[model samples]
Target: MLKGLIFDLDGVLTDSAKFHLAAWNNLAQELGIKLTSAQLDSLRGISRMDSLNLILKYGKQENKYTKTQKEEFAAEKNEKFLEQVETMTPADILPGITELLADAKKAGLKMCIASASKNAPKILSKLGIASQFDQIVNPALLERGKPDPEIYQRAQQLLQLHNDEVISFEDAAAGVAAIKAAHQFAVGIGDKQILKGADYIVKSTKELKLDKIVAVFKRNNKKVG
Candidate 1:
């Protein structure tokens, strides 16, 4: 019985990758670093600090910055990202997300966001869908980020639901890893190969139907049982 749904905000709900990329690129340019497209993709589903470390390492300057300096860089990037976020409107909600939220509400499923972003609430509100979620797990409260189960575990706890009663939607490999690690059903919303660990995969949210997802979850749960 899938009683709850956990969602990753960025790629899953709306495409914030452009905003993130623009911010990272702006910061990289300031530091005289050039990031490849592949490098930008790798930042998905990771914390701000972790992404900064990866960028610094790629630029061969990881050893050059103190923790405080790195924090400043991350903060600078976030300010730029927030500027983009501020421009978001309900029109920015991705395809099928509005339909999915309506369907989930109709089905009486509890919903929450389990994201690496500290800006989850702002993003959701800007998309005009903040009222749909029961909670948005605060990444800052967790000891670990995506690829670790802590964030999802915290979301599940907040939802007051058993892990087996939840299905988590994610767009990144790390997010799928976290969902599975938390003993929940993992529905990946991206390339199947990249999110191979997921119990189910859809190329995009537009393909998601509540009834179909429930059917799949039950079948998979039975097999696991």
Candidate 2:
């Protein structure tokens, strides 16, 4: 049986990734660093500091900013992101997510969120689902973010569940990689090509089937032990 569900917040629970992209892109433009949409997409699911560093490295703008300057730029991006997110409503919940969460909770599965966003808790609160999760592991508590497995691992530990007892749902490549790195089964939600390594891929959260997720967990458990 699947004992827990670990979710990635931005793209999975809410459609806030676009706001993040906009914030970053706006900052990059102000800094005189031109970033293509493709480059911006690559930064998804990464921490603000890491994303800024990557942008600096790739844009060859590292020499232009001191550590303090970089921090200021990152702060500016987050400010814009928060401003945009202030407009989020319950309607912003991803398709089938409310139903999925309700079903999972009813099925006796513990739920948690493992996200790179520092504002995850607030977002959940705003959505009126803050109390739904048993735990929430976000960037604020971690030294690193997605693709590093720290946040996911922290969530697993907090939930007191083994890897086999839980499944991760993610939409970004970095999130999928982190879940897999932590030796957990991952359900990807988004472009199939980018989510090729996911144990299963669904076009949206609406496509998620609880029975199928549980069955996969059972099958994996049997194979492992």
lDDT of 2 by residue, 1-225 (tens): 578999999889988999999998888888778998789999888888999988887789878888999889999999999998889889899888898898998988999889888889888977888999999875676887779888888999989998888999999899999999999999999999999989889998888888887787788778888
Question: What TM-score quantifies how close candidate 1 is to the native fold?
Answer: 0.97
The per-residue C-alpha lDDT of model 2 at residue 71 equals 86
Which candidate leads the pack in lDDT?
A: 1
Clash pairs, model 1 backbone: none
RMSD of each: 1.0, 1.2
lDDT of each: 0.91, 0.88
The residue ranges of model 1 lying beyond 4 angstroms of the native Cα positions read none
Error of 2 at 71 (Å): 1.1
Regions of candidate 2 where Cα sits further than 4 Å from its true position: none
Error of 2 at 35 (Å): 1.3
